[model samples]
Target: MSYVLGIDIGTYESKGVLVDRNGKLVAQSAVPHKLEIPHRGWAEHDAEATWWHDFKQLSKSLIHMARMNYGISADEIEAVGVSSIAPAVLPIDRDGTPLRKAILYGVDTRAEREIAALNEAIGEERVFEIGGQSLSSQAAGPKMKWIKHHEPEVYEKTYKFLCGSGYLVYKLTGQCVIDRYTAVNYAPLFDIHTLEWNDESVSHMTEADKLPALTWSTDIVGTVTRQAAEQTGLAPGTRVIAGTADAMSEAISIGAIHQGDLMMMYGSSTFFILTTDRIMKTKELWPNVHIVPGANTLTGGTATAGSLTRWFVDQCLGRDMGSGEASNWSVQQAYTYMSEQAGLSPPGSNGLITLPFFSGERTPVHDASAKGMMFGLSLNHTTADMYRSLLEGISFSIRHNLDVMQELGASVKRIVSVGGGVKNELWLQSVSDICQVRQAIPEITVGAAYGNAYICGMALGWHDNLEEIDEWVNIIRHIEPGVNDREVYERHYAIYHRLYERTKDLMKDL
Candidate 1:
């Protein structure tokens, strides 16, 4: 029997899945990894150690599991699909050796100075016109320029600059190519109109030739090489597709392909991708070509969601993350206790409001120096109230992005929720209640890895068209907004906005 393999490298963990040709899961594996934070605003991963090593480990484990349990051999897997936390800037030498650790997505704000320089050199309006989005920390182009200015020697020896997925594709197939949807993050260096590399505005950073070739997310780029096969226990000729960002794959996994279909991925950060028939060009939201041909998407994201919740648990609950000490409870048990405590608190948390900008804000606000704040704190408040308010704060951030998209003439007909965050019922309920929108959770929410497998099916001609995704995906549950607390939330949301506006300057100064 024929099968396919899919893997995704995420912020805190990596997951892989082995599935039959008909979308039946046969085996899966996951491994956790550390996120290196050397400086306050800098986030990084050793591309060779973290990314490539995780890929090898996950691939071998999945392959072994499939072989032992399902009687599947290495050659039986027809194709491999991959996705990763993307728009990361990883520079490599001529022989595909990583020069330095990769600078991660929008969460890493070390390129603010480069962003400002680029905006001044090439007017912001011109950049928007050429790239279909404004310069921000999310833009990989500025991060590339930052490397050139700060690490001149490494930049000089750089042969190709690749994203996370592109780096893995190279390790497997010896081909460097990035999907169009992922390339949008390289704004001003990638022309949204031409759908190709454009170095006119970013020649000071690097030339277009230094970038990977662009391809559709499902297009077959090359075959796994003998070296990779030996390392990962796969057939040498296994097909590899041009993969996309983890968020895009996560969106596709839930069959969010139609216009007005919005996918909210609650991972380390919360990402929103609203599929559209036409490009929605706005500086507040990113406009990009969708994985589906002839379609587009307006994407926005929050800098913190799951990460913020994890932080609260680690810092406030007396849970020592370094030593894995949580009194007598496991990490999962601690989270369960936290969620139950949060649920006991009222919707408004008795007048507490939190700003979830611990890693600085992304989307609409676009403030890299933004700081996390908890307002209305008094002796009357308890730990439960604080946790509840933190959840509401994250909900408010989601609502803020949705409101911005609505004001820009975008409609949200359906909201499909995915990711590890979906397991938190309190957080999901808070989001729906705050946004006043319904959310649908899919049955097989294996996330980006599942989407990668389906993309591999398309690449191998096992799936006919995009609409066939419906046969594999089904909505299992729905969360409708609660109306009783609307007024209370409305009042708190106003305070949430006003507090930020009033204290943003102080946050920057401090």
Candidate 2:
């Protein structure tokens, strides 16, 4: 029997899965890592260690697991697929090694100055006309401009700029290529109408040749090279497909592949991907080209989602626990206590409100200088209340983003929830109640790997049909808005929405 290997590089962790031709998972493994905050507004990743290193180890372990546990051989692996945080910028040298830390998507606000300069120079209207989205930290063109202007030395030596998926694909196949869906993120540099790199108008930051060749997500870019096989234990010449962003892969994981289907990925960040019939441009939301050639999607994401909760658990609660094993135990105990406490607390978090802009806000507000806030905290408030407030606050942001998408003429027939954060039922319920949108929770919430594996299956002759993927996914139940919590959140959401506006001036000063 043939099997496909799918791996995804996430914000805090990376996961790999081996799936049989029947869509049954044979082996799975994950590696956890940290996101580096070097400065107040900057976030980054050591692309080699966090991305490529995790990939090699994850691949090796998955191969061993498949062989010992599932009785599958390396040659039996048909094709490999990968997905990662996107719209990221990592400049590479001629040898394809990263020149410096890769600038992360949306959360990395170091490029704000670059974003403003681009807007001032090119005009926002022209950028939106070509890129389908306004220039922002999430747009790759500005980030590359930041590199060129700030680190002229690095830009001069750069051979190509690659995203996470492209980096891994190159390591495996040695072919420099990026999917069209991600290519759009480099807006103004990429013309959406033609799906090609625009050199005539926008070529100041870097030459068009420095970018990877654009390809469809499902297409096989190249086969694994001899060097990659020795390090990862995969057979030589194994086909590798051009992978797309994690959110798009997650949408496929839960069968939310049709137009009007919305995917909310509750991972390191709360991301929304809405499938559309055609491209609809808006400054508030990112209008994306779909993995499927003729389709389109509206995409948006908050800078922090699970990462906010994670910080509270690790930095705040786990502080006293010290290092090593004690720290992990402390985090677990803190989460356990908080989860129970949140369950007992009333829906509105005891009249408390929090603005979930810990890593700066994205979509709707799109404020890079936004700061987190906790209003109405009293001495009587418990740790549980604070944690619950965090969830509620994040849900408010989710609603804010969804409102923008709907206002901009995108229809949402269904919402599919994916990623690690969905495991938190309280957070799920809070998002549903606050957003007033029902969410379909799939059986396998770890959606990206399966989605990636399916793409690998496409690389081989084993999968021409996506309908087969539907069978692997089962939407167990829907999280409907609670009648009791709805009105309570409504009263709070109005204030939550205004929190940013009221604080924007002060936030910028910070």
Candidate 3:
């Protein structure tokens, strides 16, 4: 039986899935990783060890699992699809090897100076006109400028600048390409309307040729070469699709294809994707082309979500993260304990509130200097109240983004929740209560890895159109808002908005 394999490299863990033509998941695997903070407000990943290494291990293991348990052979795997965190900056030499550890996405705030300089040089209004969003640390192009200014040797030796998915495509098929949806995050350098890179945007310092060739997310970029086949255990000549960012893949996994479909992806960050009919731009949000041709989407996200929870658990719960695999169960136990305690806390966390900007805020505010704050902390409070307050803080942030979407004339007909956070009953239900919108949880909440597998099915012609996703998506449960708790959260939501502005300067002075 022919199979299509998909893998996604995420913030905390990497997941891979193997699926047959009928859209059934056959085998799956996961690898947990820790974020590397080499400096204050900077995040980096060893490209070869974290990204490529995880892919190699997961691909081989999934292939073996399929062969042994499902009676499927490696040769039967017909196509491969990949997705990863985007707006990443990785400079590579002529041979496509990473020159240094890759500078990660929005969470990495090392490019603040470059972002300011670019906004001043290009004019924020003109940038929004061309790219549909104002420049922020999230854009990869300015991070490119960061290297040229600081790491000149690395810049001189660089040949191509590739993000996660594009780099994977290169390793697999020797084809270097990035999908339009992901490439759009390289703002100022890429023209959203025309879908091409330009030198004029960066004052000609950036060479347009160094950027990967653009392709649609589902397009088959190339077939696997023998070298990649040997390394990955995928069959030689297997079709490899030019995939997209993990958030986009998460959007596709939940059937957020048509206009007005919104996906609330709760991973390391809280991301929202609202599909629209025409281009939409806002200083508070991001705009990009949808995976489908001619469609558009507006996106907003927070830099902290699951990552923030993990930080609290590791710091206060004594997980011994440095002790490795044996300590993982302890960390899991701590999470369960926290969730149970959080459930006991009353709505609004007994008058507690956290800003949820541990890693600076993204979307709407875009304030890098913002710091996390927790108010109403008293000796009488317990860890349970604090944990619940953090969860509510994240929910309030999501509501803020949804409100922005509404102000932009986008109405949400449905909200699909996916990612690691879906299993948290409180987080899902709290968002519903705070936002007053029901959320549907799909049967398979395997996150973006499953979405990448679905993309592979589409690329292989197993599904003529995205409507076929209906077969794979079956809502297991509906999380509805509690009417009685609405007033309490309604008041809290207003305060959540005000607390940020009141604390903005205080946070900056820190």
Q: Best candidate per lDDT, number?
A: 1
Cα lDDT of model 2 overall?
0.86
lDDT per residue (tens digit) for residues 338-358 in model 1: 899888889899889999999
Worst 10 residues of 3 by lDDT: 320-329
1 versus 3: better lDDT goes to: 1
Give the residue spans of candidate 2 off by over 4 A: 320-334, 465-468
Q: Model 2 over residues 1-510: C-alpha lDDT tens digits? A: 888899999888899999888788899898888788889878899999999999999999999998898688899887999999988899999998899999989898888887888777887788788888887778888889989998999999999999999999999998889999998988778988898988754675678789899999999989999999999999998989999898888888888877788989998898888888888978898888877578888999998888888777766555533112355565446656667788887999999999988878888788888999999999988878888999999999999998887788789999999988887889999888888889999888777888999877766767665546677788899998888867788899999878778889999998
Question: How well does each candidate superpose onto the true structure, as a TM-score?
Answer: 0.98, 0.97, 0.97
Clash pairs, candidate 3, are none
In order, candidate lDDTs are 0.91, 0.86, 0.86
Give the true-structure RMSD of model 2.
Answer: 1.7
Misplaced by over 4 Å in model 3 are: 202-205, 319-328
Q: Is candidate 1 or candidate 2 better by TM-score?
A: 1
Q: What is the lDDT of residue 303 in candidate 1?
A: 87
